[model samples]
Target: MSGDPADEQLVRQAQGGSRAAFDMLVLKYQRRVERLLSRSVRDPADVADLCQETFLAAYRALPGFRGESAFYTWLYRIAVNIAKRHRARQRPLESLEDGEGTFGTDAAPSDDATPEALLANRQLVRGLDEAVQALAEDQRRALLLREVDGLSYDEIADLMDCPPGTVRSRIFRARESLSARLRPLLEGRGGRRW
Candidate 1:
């Protein structure tokens, strides 16, 4: 039963049949859940639905929650599971090589950029996406949770169910791998690293 005292208190209230307490938790984390789901689910409507589904499932399972992890961590797992299932039913994950979307740098090119510059930017983004996709699952997850989600190492460790040292190591390895893979692309562009 270790977590934020506020969340722990809320959980106890919810477990004791307090719907308002549960609603407060939902209000607090709904945006975060939506953000997490949006990473995998492209459709805004689908993301909204999945967010609702996640909360519904969490509410039903509240009684059984033993506070092994932080409430948000547990909720995060539920959101992730819901998103994964939604993705599996929709389509295979989009790929960088598909040329339909960019993963890392979503910024559109400046208005005055030449066609070649736009093409190069696209290539750089594609390269980063490919490099990221090539990482081992654990490394990829750790890196994304840290870099993209802005989660602290300790928070990532809690979500990942590993030590903070392991989270740091995984992020380090993932970054090293990305740098190695992207070195050629970066060097080709005047040695600038994005």
Candidate 2:
């Protein structure tokens, strides 16, 4: 009903056990929370559970919020920790898929093409995927958050607990690495190009 209601007021109301206030907060943060989790989570479906857990934790700690940092910062920290922990817990069974066998002999994902174009596309994706995989973890995370999850640099910084400058640097490095890695594909030198 007003021009941009304040988040602090909403938070205070939520903290006081106002379900409507909490719902508003949830609606405001839902997309961001999902994006933050999706940046690292392989299975997007699993993001729902993680988002809930993050919010649950936030709700529990809401009263303790000192406002030392913005609410989104605090929420971002919770989301990142939850995502990182979830990633860590699944790490033993999960790997970056090293070696030729994991990616197949082609070194890429299947192409969206047919017949003559099919093999070429697959090689393209493979080369691109490998290039992305080769990036350093921090760079890869930033790049993935942007390219895959479609998050803004500010959102990425929040999720990574870093400054926007750092996020930009990582993404730049990642794009460079990926471009170099995929260069062969672009030139049709790696496998096939037309």
Candidate 3:
């Protein structure tokens, strides 16, 4: 983590239109922005667009930024907003019944699926991952904030600029969606599904 003083210095330079300083800021926060975008916008291409939008918005808004929130907190807020806009502007995913396949990024398939019918297990895991990617934007956001970023509900609420209760509910809904989608795969002896 950058020390408070270093953060403040960068913030000031970014606000003053120091391109290198702003680029550094973007580098520092890119992963968080990418994660935020991934949860809100399932397509890797869309996520990339949102990440760019997040940084651009942050650059525009930096001059007026108050230190009331941590810099990262504020930056995340921009990413969330950018992702929301992207989701809103784009057509949503077709339903599971509609034959769309895959969600989020994939790791190369491994034999972690059922030993008996490895291909079937791989398909099952892939389906569940798609279901997670197909989650509602708010639910995906909250779940990723908790699971991926390891943020507290309150902290998530702050980043989301919503109430903690809302954050908790989104998390619950997201988990339900994931669990329901993954139950079949999890039922097997292998036990765990990533």
lDDT of 2 by residue, 1-194 (tens): 11124888888798888989978888998998897676466565789999999999999999898766667778878998898899878854333343231133453435554566766655665676667656787888788778767779987787677999999999887787777677777875553322
Q: lDDT by residue for model 1 over 1-194, one digit each (tens)?
A: 87789999999999999999999999999998987776566667988999999999999999899998999999999998888788778766556433533264567778899999888888887888778778997898899888888999999999988999999999999999998899998887887655
Cα RMSDs, all models: 2.7, 5.9, 4.2
For model 3, state the Cα shift of residue 183 in Å.
2.6
lDDT of each: 0.85, 0.74, 0.73
Residue 193 of model 2 has an lDDT of 28
- Pairs clashing within candidate 1: none
What's the number of clashes in each of the models?
0, 2, 0
> Which regions of candidate 2 are displaced past 4 Å?
1-5, 91-114, 146-159, 189-194
- Predicted structure 2: lDDT: 0.74
In the range 133-181, model 3's lDDT, one tens digit per residue, is: 7788678767877887899998888778899999999988888888878
Candidate 3 error regions (>4 Å): 1-5, 95-105, 109-117, 130-137, 162-169, 190-194
Best by lDDT: 1
TM-score of 3: 0.72
Q: How accurate locally is residue 180 in candidate 3, as Cα lDDT from 0 to 100?
A: 78
